[model samples]
Target chain A: MKPESAVVSITVNGTPHRLEADTRRTLVDLLREDLGLTGTKIGCGQGTCGACTVHVDGVRVLACLLLAVTVEGGQVLTIEGLGTPDGGLHELQQAFIDRDALQCGFCTPGQIMSGLGCIGEGRANTAEEIRESMSGNLCRCAAYPGIVAAIADVAEGQGA
Target chain B: MRPFEYARPSDLAQALAAAGPDTVFIAGGTTVVDLMRLDVLAPRRLVGLGDVAELRRTELDGDPVRLGAGVTMAEAAALPLVRERYPALAAAIDLAASAQIRNVATLGGNLLQKTRCPYFRDASSPCGRRRPGDACSALTGHLEQRAVLGASPHCVAPYPGDMAVALVALEASVEAATAAKVVTVQVADLFREPGDAPHKETVLGDGDIITAVLLPAPRGTSAFVKLRDRASFAFAAASAAVSLELDHDRVVAARIALGGVATRPWRSSEAESAVSGERLTPERAFAAGEAAFEAVARTHENRRGIALGARAVTAALLACRGG
Candidate 1:
């Protein structure tokens, strides 16, 4: 049976998008599927993995757990919203490259987004704090040390 | 996922009106969305409570600290009053899920969140909690994470939330609102032990919405200690929440609750009684912990949880003493 779709509007990276989204469609699905923003990855599909982390109203949330229609008239910031590949990378993204924070790169988007939120919340003052705050985004490749370094660097005004 | 109608009502009355036998209310969708994706829960109508702003209010001015049902775990944990007045509650909320999840997971949803028992989650497995009269796979398959204190022949799935354990120890009351009236119920009485009907988890009636949770004024020093597989982003293997009132070195009053070792938020009046009138000592605390799990029935794999739970209780009690 086909799920009924609803007309929902949200500002994605300063661009207002009005689309007909399935009521059951998650925020991640809305970004990756309907909006053609494939940066947000769905790892566990459950809220367990933070691979689908995104900013809703400037607060970081698990996109996989949020319904698309629930964020009507809200501002959403995904990985693609952070920086452009051709233009320039965000400081955090640059720090990640410099620090080699990623290995397989599957969990990098979530790590960067969560790191941005951690820094924005002023929770990345110390390495321990960075590690604790970024515990949501799991990296199976064991690139935690580098990721922590990159986040710590960006947090301490050492990046970009 | 099964197709479901979504309704975002602007008021509580509309939200209630939209709810029916086949309807389920969603706050942050941390638990409901996950279950829906897993096909564990497939409600025909999804009633969104996001627009009901009254449910998100947090009032901590006086006697009973009122936390609206939609108060997110992050908001509750970050509240200075909640941290100072009810450290156990704050700690429990802080120790749950992750930063991203905590930002959106509501207090009401946390209490109503289902067990993380592998069998209950995996639809293919025979789970008495997920499917009535189904053989509990956790009973024999993997008993390590199963409940020990509140086990029945039918189910051994442990209640997975840390906030409820703290709330129960704090002697909190939940204000449940229905179409007709509102009734306040003790937090400890909210959950039903999984017996013949493991699927029936809570005592909430049809269309009963938890509006707020009222927490009594802080009596004494409280602490929450959780032992889990990892340091963060994991459910407790054994956890304890203790609130103790002491005169000098002697315990005047104590409330003890254990989690991750029971089918529900297990509050031990026996443990509270054991600690009362006794000096805050390691031996006494250990004895009180033992009293809490005196009649605990453990499976072959989860026997360690019994000992671990006792240790957690003792540790929390000692922490309350500033030891």
Candidate 2:
């Protein structure tokens, strides 16, 4: 049988969209394929790696594990939404650049998104805490030291 | 993945009404989505429990602490009351998965999460736990992740979860809404060992919906210790949840539960007996740990896991003593 579809009304970043998506389509697929927001990377589709991390209703969650239809009424914040009001880079994004947090830059978006979540959740107080909290987003390039430094810089308001 | 219809039920009644043999209730979708993608579970219909507001509560101040089934692991673990009173449960939630997973994975879904057995998760493999008559591939493939306790000939896949172990040690109960009426099941009894039917993991009926998890008042000083391949974001290779009530120096009561080495969340009566009436010294703690795994099926494949299981018990007990 063909997959069922649902007309979903969701808010992405600051924009609202009503899209007809297959019930089986994951949130990551919906964001990248349907909405063309390719900033969020899909590392492991089975939730093992946190490359598809995004914010749904201000909570950090794996997009691959969530069905797009299940988040019908949710407000999603993707990596593309982290820019400032003046079109400048977000503090965390600038911190990532300043700290050289990316070697290959594939996991950088997810790292930045999850870094915002960690700071919001008060898990970015120390370098150890930042590493433990950001353990979800894996950078295969092994840029963890710079990632921790970038998140800590923003969390401590030093990068601002 | 097979095509499936989805329904977002707003309440418990509607959710239970939609339940059937071909239907699955999904909250966080961490396990269901993963398994569905693997073609392990191809339910025709999925009832989304995310919109059910009544099941998302966190009532921790009452006598019998009640945590709604829809409450996310991150939400529950962040509560100061949980960390202060039930350290084992808090630690269990904290140590279970990554930050992003805990943010969406609910307490109820975590308890029902499927085994990480490579054979069970792969659709191409013949797994007794996935199909009733199929052979368990883990028996001949890899024994490192197989269960050492409560394993039947049909299946040796261990239950891969953390919170359930602490709940069993804390004597928690689960409240559910069935088609006929509401019922409460003990956390320990909720999970079934791999007996003749390895597929029957729980006693829940087709239409049964878990509503809440009830926890008793804090026992004595409690701790949860987990040993895994990685320091973070990995399933436990061997773990122990221990709660000890000390009368000055002697033990008044003790509850010991083991995970990662058992087919289910295992309560060790042998370990309880070893330390209940005696003072909990380091030697006594080590003895209790050994008692926990004394009856386990020891093999060359699981020798290291058994040793780690014993050491986990010892570490948890000593941690409860503030050592």
Candidate 3:
């Protein structure tokens, strides 16, 4: 049987959008393909990679694992919602730039999104806590030291 | 992934009514969506349990702490009452998955997570758990992460959740709602060993929606220790959950549950009996650990799990003493 599509009305980065989405479409695909918000990358296409990390109702979630229709009326936030180069950068983003937290930049968006969540949850108080909390977002380029430093810098109020 | 119809029911009755033979209930979708993407599971209908508000509550100020199935792992771990009363459960849930996953994955979904056996994940490989008639590749193939205890010749896949192991040690019970009535079953009775039917993992009936898990009030000091390949974001290689009551520095009661080396969340009555009336000395803890794995069957690649599991039990018991 052919699966039916449903209309989902969601608020993304303070902007409301209503779109006809396939029931099988994942949130990551909906963001990248349907909405053209390609900042959320699909690395493992599973929950392990964390490359598709985003925020739904202020909670960090794996976009690849969440169905688009399940998040109806949810407020979604992606890396693009954090800040832009022209509009200025979020504190965490600036910290990432200052700490040199990116080598390939493929995992930066996920790292930033997950880092925002870690800080929002108040779990970035120490280096061990930062590393343990950020373990889901794997950086294949081995940029963990700088990533931790960046998160700590913002969490500890050393950087903006 | 194959296309499927989705339904978000607002109440337990509607949720149970939406479920059918070809339907699967999705809470966090951490495991279900991953398997579906791998083509390991393809259900024609998906019933979303997110809209059921009653399933997301947590009540801890009573004799039996009731944790709603929809309560996320992070929420459960961070609850002050849970941390004070059931430290083993808090540790188990905290050490599982990652921060992002803990924020989204629910307790019910965590209980029902599938194995991490490579053969089971890889569709090309023969896995009895994935297909009942298929061959068991882990029996002769790479068996490092396979089960060492409660394993049958049909399947060697291990249950990969840390929460269930702690629940078994804490003597928790799950409240499940069906179309007919609600039933409460012990966490220990929830799993079925892979004796002949490796495919039948749990005893959950058709249309049974797990509503909540009831944890008895804390009886003793408890701790959970997991030995894994990595510090975090990895499943346990060997783990132990221990709860002990002490009187004048002597063990009055003990409960032990093991993980990462069993077909299911293994409660070791032998280990508990070993230290029931004895002082919890280092030697006695080691003896209890040995007793836990006395009857364990090990393969060529999984022999290390026996010793590692023993050490985990000893370490967990010692940790209960603040050692």
Candidate 4:
């Protein structure tokens, strides 16, 4: 169904974009559909799953739960912005790869996006804290051990 | 997400006026937006309170701090005043949803969040709250883990979120603005009992907008505890928010409220009086918790309600004592 209202201007990964989207359209759908930035996925859709996670105004938010109109004039960052095309992943992404933190690859993008904010915000000070913070995003494969390792690896390397 | 007309009002007055026949006031849109997508709210008008600046402020009003309804859980949790003076409220927000959801979920939205009854979320299910004529599937099927307190003839649903208990414990109040006038109501009396009207949650009329949540200064050491199947992700099976004002080693004042086990946020002066004059002790805390829940009528399958609620209340009291 077409959304009856809302015209929003969003800066996705530093690129200015405009769309006359509906209130029903979520930030994740806007990114993936209108802008074709499908890097952000949708899982639980109820904000329980981190699959649709993104950073809005320098903070992490579940895009699945955020209305497109609510984010007008805000800066949004997704996993697609964290690294270069030269295979040089962000430090968190590199740590995830080094630690084999993913299995099915379905939750990797969300995990990476959340991890970026976790490390960037300096909240991943301890493994326990990372585990506690990451509880919202579920890994059906239960790949927690590897995920923790990836986060801890970054914190440890940072001398945290 | 079902298609709907969206309006982003720049101010509170505009937003309140915009709320009408099928309009919902959305702040953060962390919970209400999802429900709209589920078609749970087929409101033709989606009024965005996001741009309403006055509704996003946090300031002191007399002895209490007035937090605008639009303040997100994450922002509220990170506030210095919230962390210092309202640890229980802060913890409740910190423990809710996730960092991601908290970043977008507002305090007013948290209180206004619908029940987490799986039946209610499933539109096809026979839930009285969703469909007037539908039978309460939860009343007969999978009655375990349903409401243990304040169950009504129309529904046996449990309020899922954790912030309500904390707010109730702190004696928080709300400023509700309607198309006609704005009124202040206590958090303790905000919810309307689901006697015959299962759909009515708050007393606010069709065009009312929740302007702000005014939280009184916590009287004592405050703590909020939730007992859930999972440490996170899951809603509370039982929860309690306890505030204790100690006269050195003796209890001077106490406020207690419970969640998950009640249809609405349950506050018990009866429970607080049980330990009002006693010295801080585990036995006293236990006594207060039991007294507060003495009126609780737990069913067979969810007998754990009393136990979990008691444990949460006692734990909060103990936290007050720093024990």
* Selected candidate, larger DockQ, 3 vs 4: 3
Q: Compose the digit string of candidate 3's lDDT tens values, residues A12-106.
A: 88889999988888999999998999999999887888999999999998998898988889999999998775788998999999999999999
- Chain A TM-scores, per candidate, are 0.93, 0.95, 0.94, 0.92
Cα error, candidate 1, residue B136 (Å): 2.7
Candidate 2 residues B1-323, lDDT tens each?
A: 88889988888888988888789999998999999999999999999998888787668788789999999999999989889999999999999899999999998899999999989988999988998898878877865777888988889998989999999889889998898898999999999998878999999986798889999998898899999998898999999999889987788999999999899999999999999989989899989989987876567877877888889999999999888
RMSD of each: 2.0, 1.5, 1.7, 2.0
Q: Model 4: what is its DockQ?
A: 0.74
Using TM-score as the yardstick, the better of models 3 and 4 is: 3
Give lDDT tens digits, candidate 4, residues B1-323.
55668787888788877867867777887778777777777777788788888787778545668888888888888888889998889988877778888878888888888997878887778887887667778877775677777788788898787998898998889987777777999988988666677788877776777778887767768988888898776788888898888988899889989888888898978778888888978988888778866776555755788888777888888888886
Q: List where candidate 1 sits over 4 angstroms from the true fold.
A: A1-3, A84-86, A158-160, B297-299
Angstrom error of the Cα, residue A98, model 1: value is: 1.7
Q: What digit string (tens of lDDT, one per residue) describes model 2 on residues A1-160?
A: 2348888899999899998888999999999999999999999798877889999999999999999988888999998998988899998999999999999999888888899999999888888888888889899999999999989988888432
lDDT of 4 by residue, A1-160 (tens): 3558668899998999987886667889899999999989899887777988889999888888888888899999998888886867788888888889988978888998887677766678888788878887788888888998998888778876
Best by TM-score: 2
For each candidate in turn, the TM-score is 0.96, 0.98, 0.97, 0.95
TM-score, chain B, model 1, is: 0.97
Using Cα atoms, each model's DockQ against the true complex is 0.73, 0.80, 0.78, 0.74
Q: Output DockQ, candidate 3.
A: 0.78
Docking class for model 3 is medium
